[model samples]
Target chain A: MDLVDFARGPALKAAFIIFILGIVWRIVNVLLLRHKRILSEPRRSVPVALLAGLKGTGSRSWPHPEFIKRTVTGEALGYSYHIGLFIVILLFAPHIIFFGSFIGARWPALPNSVVTIFAVITITLFVAVLARRLGHPVLRHLSNFDDFFSWFVVALLLVTGLMATAHVGAPYHTILGLHILSFDLLLIWYPFGKLMHAFYIFPTRAVDGYVMTRKGAPS
Target chain B: MNTSPVDFQANLAPEEAKLGESARVAGAMRGFAREIGALSALRLDACVHCGMCADACHFYIVTEDPQYTPVLKVEPFKQVFKREAGAFAPVFRWFGLKAKITGAELARWQHLLYDSCNLCGRCSLMCPMGIDIAELIEQARRGMFEAGLAPKELYEKAAHQRRTGQPEPSDEPYRDKLLAIGRRFNVEIPLDKPRAEVLLTVPRTDIEHYPAAVAALVRVMAHLKADCTFRSDGLVAENYGYYAGGRDWQREISRRLIDQAVACQAKVLIVPECGHAYSALRWEAAELMGKSLPFKVLHITEYLAEALEAGRLRLRTAQVGATAFHDPCQLVRKGGITAAPRQLLRAMGIEPRETVRHIGYNICCGGGGGVFDIERAATLRHRVVEEKFHEIDQTGAQTFLTTCSDCRRTFDDGKKRFNWELTPGSLLELVAEHLQGG
Candidate 1:
């Protein structure tokens, strides 16, 4: 089979299956594990706790005041790239087309140039994140195989996807196939790696906020 | 360096001295495996390894040591979870990618979990992913305890609590001390008063070293005309099992009070100004006992705040000068006693000044998590205290007010050792001293 045919037919189908099933498996495996019962009477009402948790999902995105003095650069870079990744993945015109084909859903996407700019920013920030991981002593010690590997995979996916869209480094059809293949690899790796944070962060932050707020702590 | 915090080292038997490294590793792994339930499993999985927690941890912020980073402290446990409990465990095992946990490795982890971490929960607060690093460390401590890798002071303290059901160093009956202090103050200290409205418990440290503070609590109880009693059976509030990371011992220590409160038919169980004591009772006791307590659990500050809020307790509105409130890690950050002390101070007509970091974000006094009792951690503890000392200094307050007795004692130690000018005092004591009428 030609590269384009293989990429579109079997490889994409496999990626789709793996992406869906892997995420389901991870969420189930984690959610189903038995937790110790919280026996203390919650200090506040359950609704208040839930509200606090909801508040925390947005509030925890920013660092505490003490850390804010020194962490503005890191925080800005992190938020910019994460937001960029979201736009490039869901709001890009090509991605919407792909989604329309798979799930029969449609939405307007950002202009191709805008998508390309986001891709460039994401790739640059990904490189900077890796540099910080390696150069900063604390980050270096905390960085593991999962961290570096996830960074590499996502960066490669963005670069290839941008190249496919911009018609650079190869013929458009060939670059698109390469981009699909790289994304397929990322899909298979997502649920098993640190990329699972995308799904887990909000729920975890909410639960923490709920508990803290129930105790009448500042959430 | 400093003398061993306890005498456990001198009495270490030959067999105890020579650790079975493999068995200890297995034991630690078993503890980890047992404790890795859904919530902990989720927390373990959520970490992005961004090292933002380092900024939150006073241990790392003060020392600038990468190893002391909060996230790094839990790295080994995360590896264990990935290899044994993760969805891709079989793949990890097939590739032989799992690092082997050894006894010596666990021995080193003892320092990270106990000495460096105060279980302050600040890292959990800082985490964008809400990874509960302090709770994870508390669980990891259980694994260390199971492996017999806990610090000597911790083990000894736990053993002492197991044997005596109290943390008092002396053989003197605590009842006698309470009675003598009550007699000196001419306050009727009721012992084993059945069906009392409140069951007041004191830490052994309060009875021995801070009897005046204990007297203040008694005087406050009397002034409120509350039906409170101090039971000789479970009077001590400090739970060394918590400090030692021994889950069974913690449960045992907590159970003594639970059973007593149940027997006395008390309406409120008053926890002393001991940090971990408040945590052990106000948070962990109910979980350990497998039920919500029949009686309400309140730290003295929480009780005072409630009374003031309810218009039950009246203060004389004495001006104590510019005072700064030190939020005890366990009491404020962990227990949510944030506004109570502030409210109590205001009730006394003292507008307390805020430290640079106050309430939930306050820095630890550098002697929590039983680090004060670990001689090996003395130097590091001293260094971290300097960070807090600077914060206290910035407030420019002459007197430091804290609710937890452990924080109070640590500040006293820091004040004496570092020649700090601020006076260390308890919030309850301040309130008692400024009561409207006695």
Candidate 2:
């Protein structure tokens, strides 16, 4: 990896620990959110509904699209931005060098020109979404404490990542330490905030799709 | 060629989804939201939105608008339920501080109920989901009624039905009219015959709006000479209040209808293809009336079919030109009398042609839910029934035969609007036509 050595002593250790712990915590929270009492309609053409990608043959498929479009792109930017950030994190030259120092692993890096362009596009999309959360009435209505809190963490990651790349902070060790510290905090907070939807989305959609199938109705 | 304009509103505020703010009936929308959410997942898990119902609808036949497609009508409820009770509630409740019962929204809702739907419940049959869009519309009507946003026509009709037990604008000579029609038709239509073998009841709409169906029914009975009669004391037989969403109103009107049957000691009762009337009477008749009906209840088609099947009566099939049958939303969909009317027509050697979505998933006549709002959107009602016009044209049928009075009026509109030389008549009318010279 032909980049800076940004991760110092404690910074490297905390980052790995948070990443491992946060992902596990999120899984637990989402699993507990299921509604148990309202049983499915009894064997009402289950085979037919399963084939239709529906749970059964009774409801109107109205709002699922709106929910996905808005939430996945709106409050879910916590996960979306973080995901983009994650790739950037792995590709960061100094972070790669640090990971190599610790685990003796190295992957190919994006040349400097492409890294800057990718960074610009990723940051621009993040900013546009952030402005939307603040600007759009519907999105504003959907924002709560957790929504903004999660986004704030993403903002911190972006700033630190930028500062490390620009070499605007302290020495190699100090800038690396700030970047790692912010990344670790985000990892730990990811599961508890709006970003938790990322882990829940695939499972929840699968549940929706499968239930639709079981009911033999269209979702 | 495109008689059915697909540009319609029922979901996602296609010009009518705005929430109202009314402090008086303030709790209606929220309460509505809660109740809707209460039933959302249950309802969602219940329907498999297959296009099977397409063949059962009148709107699809007339307009060919996919928006009139039955399952799509319930979209707004799904969206509201998802935001409130599904997974998106925390941020969406009371988002900007608006209340229920706004004059504007009430007006829009009236359009949705009266103009777009008739709550005929025909779609319930084709529903792999059996989701019951008619019931949901009834629920929404109830919500609007609670908000005091009910259409003036709905309220007025309900009030009349509540007091007089019919959908007449007034009940001044309702009993006299029944007697007059039966006598004028030259049928031995007995009046107040006690312990009659059957209590064949037609909607007050049949009497007020289209008296020919009642006259036709009486003539058919006279020809059969079946021991049955209409109870003058049970003057009005329609139950409009049920679809307005008040269980009490539903019961109040239902009790009167049943009371007449019991009082006359009729052995059996037949409901005409008035959708909500049938729903309020036959489906919930046992529960709402609290006492079991002493007689078997059937749609007019059912009893007539039985009469024809037993060889007690016969028709010569006088209707000419490729005529098609419009299944009343309730008769085929809710009451499950799909085959009775068609079978009756076929036995008469009519060889009835069908619209695209005939029988179980019939489109509404745009007259159920007391949508008999003549003052507002009268043309829209006729416009809504245009879906049936093209279907009738497709069948090359010059006659439109249906069992419900509302459907009869709608078919008439379909004829006038399309400038087609079509005649609109009821099944009993067809029976009367067959037995005209008998």
Q: Choose the strongest candidate by lDDT.
A: 1
- All candidates' chain B TM-scores are 0.94, 0.79
lDDT of 1 by residue, B299-378 (tens): 88888888888989988876667888888888878887777888888887778888788788888998888888787788
Relative to the true structure, candidate 1 reaches a TM of 0.95
| Model 2, position B262: C-alpha lDDT score | 81
> CA lDDT of B284 in candidate 2?
66
lDDT of 2 by residue, B323-414 (tens): 68877665555555666777777877778887765555445666555655544556656666665566567888777777777667666665
Candidate 1 residue pairs in backbone clash: B273-B405
Query: What 10-residue stretch in candidate 2 chain A is worst by lDDT?
Result: A57-66
Q: In candidate 2, how many Å is residue B193 off?
A: 3.0
DockQ, 0 to 1 scale, candidate 2: 0.04
